[model samples]
Target: MAGLQRELTLRFLAEPADVNFGGKVHGGAVMKWIDLAGYACAAAWSGKYCITAYAGGIRFVQPIHVGNIVEVSAKVIYTGRSSMHLGVDVKAGDPKESTRSLTTHCVLVMVAVDSNGKPTEIPEWVPTSEIDIEMRDSAIRLMDMRKKIGAEMEAHIHP
Candidate 1:
């Protein structure tokens, strides 16, 4: 791994179709982009076809306007058997400057399945550097948050 590989990058110019009446990009549009980017990242790392099994915390802190271009990037965080966690970051940029500001971040858990739709094992994640370690740690925290959120939802829905 001398050459660091980019998993997936999607640039979307905030269009009227992709925005709300307020002229800001719709949350769902951002989700669609994140889903594609995350799936691609997981598939590249797993070296197999993948499906998103779960979506973690997605916070849209700032509104991206119609003229701004949003770019999404992702990388694999952890893997266990058929499950892989992919970290995604979304940034808003201006055409004048390719530089982007991080606007959203989340973790997506995906599963690799076989032709029969059964879960399939994938290569384990290996942290080669400090950045890798931080990625894994962040994934772990996100995973725990997902569990907590599930518990909260269950308390409201089932209890």
Candidate 2:
């Protein structure tokens, strides 16, 4: 069997259609791109259809202007019985500039599914490098944090 792919990177040029009334790339548009990149990375790793089960800690640190070069990178940091935890980072800068600042960062959980849309088991991923091991550990830590946050949210009554 071929080794599982753990990372994917996608680049796009920000256009007028992606901008908001503030004249910067819209948050919704960036989110859509994030999901697409995460899905692509998960599907390729699992060799099956995948869906976004959860996306958390999405933070737009800086604005991306129209005409900037945007790069979305997704890396599979951890895996479970049927899910993969991905760390996605979005960065953008002017084409003529040499530096790109981080625009957004998020963690996405993607689950593999079968034809009927039921979750299916995927090949187990083992960390082969020091960086991969550290990433996996970080994913585990984040998972714990997510559970705690979710519990807190569930306890709060909504209007």
Give the best candidate by TM-score: 2
Off by over 4 Å in 2: 1-3, 157-159
Query: Which residue pairs in candidate 2 have backbone atoms (N, alpha carbon, C) closer than 3 angstroms, thus clashing?
Result: none
Model 2 CA lDDT for position 45: 90
Per-residue alpha-carbon lDDT of candidate 1 for residues 1-26, written as tens digits (9 for 90 to 100): 21134367887787778878787888
Residue 125, candidate 1: C-alpha displacement in angstroms:
1.8
The lDDT values for all models are 0.81, 0.92
